[model samples]
Target chain A: MTGWVAVAGLGPGDAALITPEVTAALADATDVVGYIPYVARVAPRPGLRLHASDNRVEIDRARHALALAAAGGRVVVVSSGDPGVFAMASALFEALEGVPAPHDLDIRILPGITAMLAAAARAGAPLGHDFCAINLSDNLKPWVLIETRLRAAVRADFAMAFYNPRSASRPEGFARVLDLLRADCGPDRLITFARAVTTPEERIITLPLSEARPDMADMRTVVLVGNSATRRVGRWVYTPRSA
Target chain B: MTGWVAVAGLGPGDAALITPEVTAALADATDVVGYIPYVARVAPRPGLRLHASDNRVEIDRARHALALAAAGGRVVVVSSGDPGVFAMASALFEALEGVPAPHDLDIRILPGITAMLAAAARAGAPLGHDFCAINLSDNLKPWVLIETRLRAAVRADFAMAFYNPRSASRPEGFARVLDLLRADCGPDRLITFARAVTTPEERIITLPLSEARPDMADMRTVVLVGNSATRRVGRWVYTPRSA
Candidate 1:
């Protein structure tokens, strides 16, 4: 039998948040490959061999896992949050496209709780309506593309969920995005900042885009920008029902 | 000790999708209360008493769960998706507001994977930008309010995720919502129909708003309307990014 690979989302650093399908996939896998932090999340299951690696070597790790699968082993590749959302699943597919492998392997992506969804739920439905998720890293894609997408989402009146909005190297990128959003989406749009969602140190703050301070956000933060229809009722922020 | 009640989201029919905090809460709970369908999803554990009820008696079930918690039992009220998204969590809070209980019970909401998120993931990145979730039932709120919200979401250029879009008793509601969206969002907006998300029979279809027929959707279907900025790249649909 030809080997198969399943890319499973473990969810935001929680074992219980792993889906039943993901659990079954892990249980049936003879080998597992993932980033070190994500690999440690899975407790030792019988007959499960783990290949842990640093975060930087994604293509190499995916290639190794696919090779194991092509060798007739049931291998599972794990990622935190949803595998398709800036996780290893896309990289796996991208890598597979480039290589001419000997055997045909089935690639399946099992969805899990993304950080944006978790953060939105934690912050009381900031994402109750339309929204967008943008990565500000500008590492793989050009900054111009990010800027274009951001402007388009704002003009389209979408609630915005920003991932990797800011880092030590890209500190000004988030602020720049916010500035553009404020210009196009108006400064009064509600913005919810969620940090370390689902963890003990989780912090959530609901504010307006006009009042959002750059100091409050970081690489760990997931910033949610409310749509034009979003409203502030007392201390809670929500996107009102569409009419 | 004054008993505490925690409302938890179990995610969409998958046990592993339950968060770690929710799992810990359930593990520590003396009693678990939910509809039979939701209650059956979790594994049986020692010292955990279960109180399952029929589907229609949600408010009564929530009241009972709160009463049990008031009687000094560590209780957990469970909902299958996110607790706050048209689920029993709001009812629990509403019931609590009327109780006039002397003891202060800590009510914590642990987030889970809502069905909209699951459906969106299965259907590609249709929700990569702004969107809304509307319920077509109008069983509690007036249809006027639902219509108003729909228009507002569309005017705001939100991609929309509709819930309870159709039922045996209210079959025309989804069509009405589609009409309103088409009127405000125009005919070319992309619409993704997702059914039985994350299940064995999951089906996803992507089309334009003008092409989405009422016959294609039902109560189980989550209708995603792409925003004005949405574009189709071959088979994938996504909202263009704004900065």
Candidate 2:
């Protein structure tokens, strides 16, 4: 059997949000590998093996998928959102750097609806204008870099989306971010906290920066900070096209 | 009949990239309205009507959809990519702002794969770090604002994706942008030009900033500029997770 690997995105939470391209990849796979939560999203079926690992073991999971593919297995490395965006696609390429494998591996990266876009859709287009998406987890990069990006984004007046905003191990990072944002964006700027977007447990709140508390966001929440011209129309918050 | 409106994304170009949520919305819609190209993507049905208009008439299209929904017609406003990202979702809210209609209309914003992410996945993940998406068109926003944001984004070391890079009306804009980016980010930086992404005629090219010409990007293309740490890994171009 000719072996191949596909790094596919499952989209954010909802099955309906998943594209047919990813659905087809999942259907064609002999083995699916990803984080525990992401792997559980694939349906249980005969002749297909599911290998789910923990969060911090992304490199190991990428290697496992690559190894299985090299051994004549049709593998799909699943990511919760678009694999290219702070997800498995980059890690897969990173894995390739260490392996002295042939250049011609049949690998494909399928895109999906990311958390920030889903969150933007649920909350009325706070990312309607120019925007930046920043992963708030400091495990990969330094906190100083995060602060610099945040301040620069605010100064540029672009809307911002944040993923992995807070974790149990480093809950204080989001607090410092909030403090920094408050100072940079001032009190009246709008901020949106969307938890579990597109799922049954989804909760969305839009408030001014002055009233934003760090506790409003968690691991499951994606936060959106509006640009200077973003505002409320009726009940929805949106950034105007002219901005 | 009870009416509802859904601003849905059709993904970049391929029908396989469209989400089930958007497909369902199109099936349930009695009237589908959008730009000529986007409206043409929707299949015609027995009772369904398609309203394809010229570009730059987003507000008029938004008003038409709102009026149809107010008169109990199920309307789906189609945007080529994600509806909320430089697309129709914000225009709908802008229309709502002008009219004092009932606060709660059954309006929904469905997300899809934006061109940048689709292009990013097709090429490797140049957006593995924090990134910004800016529309290069100066029609909506000032050129000065674009220049300021470009400088800020580069200084922040964020990977950047540019939409609507060049148009017939202002073909010189992208050349200026290239000049500015080269000055700020330097010529050794990597840039990817992905045109007609996910379509049959798709073409993606990656080269150093020194070689990127103005004509390389047109209205159909999405341009990605990698961060300082972004480099070529084998045949793929990816930004490392650590950066």
Candidate 3:
């Protein structure tokens, strides 16, 4: 039998949000590998191996999956959201760069519903216009570049969604981000904080930039800053289709 | 029966990419409304009334869905990708601004896999880092604004995805866009053209900005311009995680 490797996205927290494509991949997999929580999401069955690693070991996980594939194992590497977006697919390819696999090895990347899109949906389309998605964490990139991108996105009048806004280790980063947004977008601009979205613990709130506190966001929060044209209609906020 | 309105995303083009959440919404729907192609993706059943309309009539279609829901009919308004991203969810909220519906009516936005993420997954994660999504069409917004956003995105050094890159009526727009990109992004920058992604007709190609032409894209194309750090590994193109 031929062996293969497929990297799939599991979508946001809701099982209902998972696509049939991803489900099928999991069903056919002989091994599932990912971060601890993500790997735990998959149901364990007989004759299946689950390899859950710690965070920041993405490259190691990718190498392991590749090695499994080389040994004639059907492997599925999973991520919470689309593996391509700040997730595992790129790390997989980065690992592939250093290794030489057979030309016929089957490798596929499956798409999933990303967190930014899921958060925007719950907030009634604050991202209806052109938008930018930025990961606020400085672990992978420099803080200077994050600031530069934020200013540029603001100058373009694009709505923005921010991932990893506030983590326990980097609580001050989100505070700096709020200050930058206030300086550029002004106090009256609207921003939404969607925490644990699509889950039972989900909580969503929209407030003016001046009223936004950095404490409202955590590791699980996805923050959205609207464009100059975004506004509220009754209980919802949305940017008009036209700028 | 109680009435509800769900603006669901069908993913890029594949049935497997559609979420079980969205599929469940359709199964419970009495009326499905959307553009002709998107509406056709849903299966026809005995109790379902499919209302497919022409393109550029999003407002009218949204109004019809609202009316159907107001009359106690379960309605599903579908869009190709996530409804929150340049799709029907905002249009429904826009229509809601002009009407007085009962506060008890059920309205939900179910997210889906969007084109950019799907395209990014297929092309190896050119959007793995910070990125912006812009619609190149000038149908609703001014061309000047589009140019301004393009310049802003380029200056920010953010990866970019362009929707509706070229059309039969506006052949020169994408050409002008290519010229602006070449001038700002430099000739060696990498760009990926992903057409009909996730579908059997899918085709992806990557090239330098200097070698890219307006004719390489069409209405079905989603063009991705990589960040300054984007490069090729073997047969794939991807942006590195760090800056």
Best by TM-score: 2
lDDT-sorted candidate list, best first: 2, 3, 1
What is candidate 2's lDDT per residue for A37-148, written digit by digit as tens?
9999999899999999999998888889889999999999999889998899989988888878537688899998999999999889899999999999999999999999
Ten contiguous residues with the weakest lDDT in model 2 chain A: A97-106
lDDT of 2 by residue, B1-243 (tens): 788889999999999999999999898889999999999999999999999999999999999999999889999999998999899999999988888754768889999899999999888899987999999999988899999999999999999999999988999999999999899889999999999999999999999999999999999999999999998877789998888
Docking class of 3: medium
Q: How well is candidate 3 docked (DockQ)?
A: 0.78
Interface Cα RMSD in Å, per prediction:
6.2, 1.0, 1.4
- All candidates: TM-score: 0.72, 0.99, 0.98
Model 2, residue B183: C-alpha shift (Å): 1.5
Worst 10 residues of 3 chain B by lDDT: B98-107
Model 3, residue pairs in steric clash = none
Question: Looking at model 1 chain B, which ten-residue stretch has the lowest summed lDDT?
Answer: B234-243
Off by over 4 Å in 3: A102-104
Candidate 2 residues lying further than 4 Å off, grouped into runs, are none
lDDT of 1 by residue, B124-219 (tens): 555654445666667766787666666656555556777778888887888777787777777888898888776677788998889988878886
- DockQ of candidate model 2: 0.86
At residue B191, what lDDT does model 1 achieve?
90
lDDT of 3 by residue, B75-180 (tens): 9999998899888998998888898743565789999999998998888889988899999999999999999999989988989999999999999999999999
DockQ of each: 0.16, 0.86, 0.78
